[model samples]
Structures are given as C-alpha cells and as structure tokens.
Target: MKYQDQLKRTLEFENTPTRIVSLVPSQTELLVDLGLESLIVGVTKFCIHPASLRKNKTVVGGTKQVHFDKIKNLNPDIILCNKEENTKEMILELEKIAPVHLSDIYNLDDALKLIDLYGKLFSVEKKSEALVSSLENKYKDFRHYIKDQEKLKVAYFIWKNPWMVAANTTFIDAMLRLNSFDNYFGNLERYPEVDLNTIKEDLDVILLSSEPYPFKSADIKELRSRFLRTKVVLVDGEFFSWYGSRLDYAFAYFKTLHQDLSD
Candidate 1:
C-alpha cells in the first residue's frame, strides 16, 4: 500500500514494519521517537541520534552511497529516504531491494506533516500527535516572545568551502523567518554560493551552523573580524538543519538564540 504525506510518498507495510532502514539521520531519530528502536535494523553512519543507537545499529552506509550487500542482509521491510539528502541513483538502487519512502522537506509545515504521516505509517498516532502538539505550543511561545521585536537581517551559512548560504524556499530560511529574523539571502535560490562582498551592506547577523561545515568558535572570531558590526553566532546545526524529532529542541534553542542576539 502507498501513503502520501506533504513531504514524501511512503509505502505502507502489510502490518507494522519489523525491520527498517533509515537513509536520513533525522528520520532515524524520528523512528526512535515512534518506539521503533528495536525494529530499526539498519541506519546510515550519520544516523547518530539517540547516540546509543549509533553504537548498536548496523551502519549501512552514507546518504549518497549505500552498502548494497549490508542492506540486503538486513532485509529491511521499508527504507526511508529524503529527496535533498540522498542521490537519485542511490534511491533507484534501494528501491530494487526494499520499499523506499522518499521525503521532500522544504519548510516547517512539511516537517510536521511528515511526523503525522510517520505516525500513521507506524501505527503510532497518539505519540506523534502529542509530539506535534508540544512543538506547536513551543512555536506559539516563540512567536509571542518575538512579536514586537525588530526583525534582524541575518545570513545563515550552511557550507563554507565555497561559502554557500541558505536561501529562500528552504527549511533553514523558514526557521529563520519563524524566529523573526529576516534572511539576507531570501531573494536567492536554494543554498547559493554568495560573495561576502555582496552581503557586506547593512547586515545585522551572520549565523554559522555547526554542521555540513562544522563552523567552530575560531571561525566565528574570524567572521567577527570581517563583519565588525554584525553579530556572529555559532548556531546548532541540528537545531536548524534536522527537520525531524530534533525540532523539539529547536524551539527552545531559538528562544535562547534570540535572547542572546538581543543582549
């Protein structure tokens, strides 16, 4: 059977899935939240959430590449994938072995929809609904706190080697907007490599994420020197990047982040 969500097309199992493989780290964490820890047979090397699971689960492969032999051995009933994270070729090959659920996330609403879909797929509706409700309350609190504040003009950097910034129509941008921060690159396309000189004018903040590039404290210091007036912050990449269960922590992080910026 097929189940469709706002983010992706999920293939339903005859019953609850017994053996599952997650290609995306965030989804792996979500699976754990849904009480599928013991049922998840395989996960990518990057599926480090619930950190103990990392030590216990089988490391199938990375997002771009999967160990066909390892996956075949695990005999997963269903495979979870993300459009932006996994390559097309990888998805095609995985489909030949097991049913593949492809999730395409562009914003917060899509994330929430996927959570609900997962609940239905795994027969964990109550758990998923409760989590979503908690997240909604947190988001409401954040809005209430920032309602009267000035929207700070900020640039969220995701990658560094080529200097790419999160642009419009992306999850990160949506999160930034939710926190009442104006994305400086909102006019650009997704994850564009922008010239620093282009964004040197009137920028309020430069956010450096902890992953994809792993921006360290030193990097923040360097950025501070370059953009003397703009505040440079080392943002938690997971809080901003992961669209799954990690969102529970993201709202509180955003609240603290906004307060830090104001101070």
Candidate 2:
C-alpha cells in the first residue's frame, strides 16, 4: 500500500506497519491513542503523555538528534516524522533504515488531515474518525463560546534567555489566533527573537509558555512588576503547539484561558 505524507512525500508499505518508530512526540501520542502503543518500538525522550511510555519503549533521542544504531537495532517497519519537529538531515538518515512518514501541520485543518491519513495508513479508520469528530466538536463549541470575547493583544513567549516568540507560520501562532489573541509579533515568520522593549503595541496579556524554556512563576512576577497593566500568565506549551490527539483538549484549555483573562 502507498501513503502520501503532509510534505507530499510518498511512502509505500507492503502492509500495515507493526513495528513503528515515532520521531515526533505529538504523533507518538496519537499512535498510542489509536491503540498502536504496542506497535511502537521507539519513541523520543519528549514523548511524555503516557508518562510511563518511555519505561517500555526504546529512547531514540530528541527532536533534533537520534541514536541511529538504537533505531536500527529495533528494526522499525516504518518511522514517523514531522516537518516542524524533525530536521531534513535527520529524515534523510532515517530514510536509510525504513520508510518515513512526515507531517507538516500549521493549522487545525492540517492536524485533522494528519489524523485522517494515519487512520488509512494503520487501518484504524474508526478510531481516527472518532478522535477527529471529538476534536471538531470541541473546537466548534469553543468557537461559539468565544464569539463574544474581545480580541486581546497577546505576546506569547516560547523561549526566555534570548527571548523568542512564535510568530507567523507556526502551529503556536495558529492556536493563538484560534483563541482570538492577536500575536504582537505576527509580522515575522517562524520563531523570532525579540526585545519586548522594542514592541510599542499595548499588549493586554503577556503569556509565558511552559516548555522549551520552562518559564517559572518568578518570571511571571518579574514581568508583572514591569508591566502593571498587562496580565502575565504561564500556559501549557503542549496544548498550543502539539497537533495530534492532544488537540482534543486544546479547545477546552483555550476556553479556560479566555475565561481567566476575562476574570
């Protein structure tokens, strides 16, 4: 059978792959949600949804790096990747071992397309269908709930040290728009480092993401002291950036975020 990935790459498999190596954390969680946990032979260190998953699966490495020999020994029937999560160089090396299915998701539609394709690829159409349906319904309800919300100007901080924000052309930015938050740095492409002092726009909220940098409460307190008018809060990075079965909860999380801001 043949399957086309989000990157327009085609992968042919003799049959549904039983031994899979998942390079992307969100996709790995999706596979587990699809009842393919037993089939996954290797996963990344970041795949922490099940929390106990790594105890059983081989730790292949991180998003940017991997242990080629460990993956080779597992002999994955197929390897899964994502354009934003995995590098092109990594994909090339992984291809030497087995067929690689790469996903490129920017918005909710793209995420759903991935889930639907996964169903066809693994012969789990019903499971994927139900999951997609659940997410769509939650998204619809959330949209309705936020229809009356005032669009707030937001600066969502993803990385600290040098200071970086998710701008245009990222899943995190898409999620921000879905929540009706106008990204202060939406003009730029990809994650860009910025000096918050340079931004003249009056931001109603300054969001600190809890990942990649692990922003602590002290950071929020420091920012709150600097910008007394703006609301500073730490948000779960997974819900905003992760595009998979994890999306089933993003809608609810977004709604709560909006409610908290209102309060």
Compared with the true structure, the alpha-carbon lDDT of candidate 1 equals: 0.87
Per-prediction TM-score to the true structure, in the order listed: 0.96, 0.98
Across residues 158-260, which tens digit of lDDT does each residue of candidate 1 receive? 8877889999988888888888889999999889998887767599999998888988888888888888999999989899889998999998888788889
Question: How many clashes in each structure?
Answer: 0, 0
Q: Number of the top candidate by TM-score?
A: 2
Residue clash pairs of candidate 1: none
RMSD of each: 1.4, 0.9
| lDDT by residue for model 2 (93-144), tens | 9999999999999999999999999999999999999999999899889889
Question: Residue 132 deviation, candidate 1, in Å?
Answer: 1.1
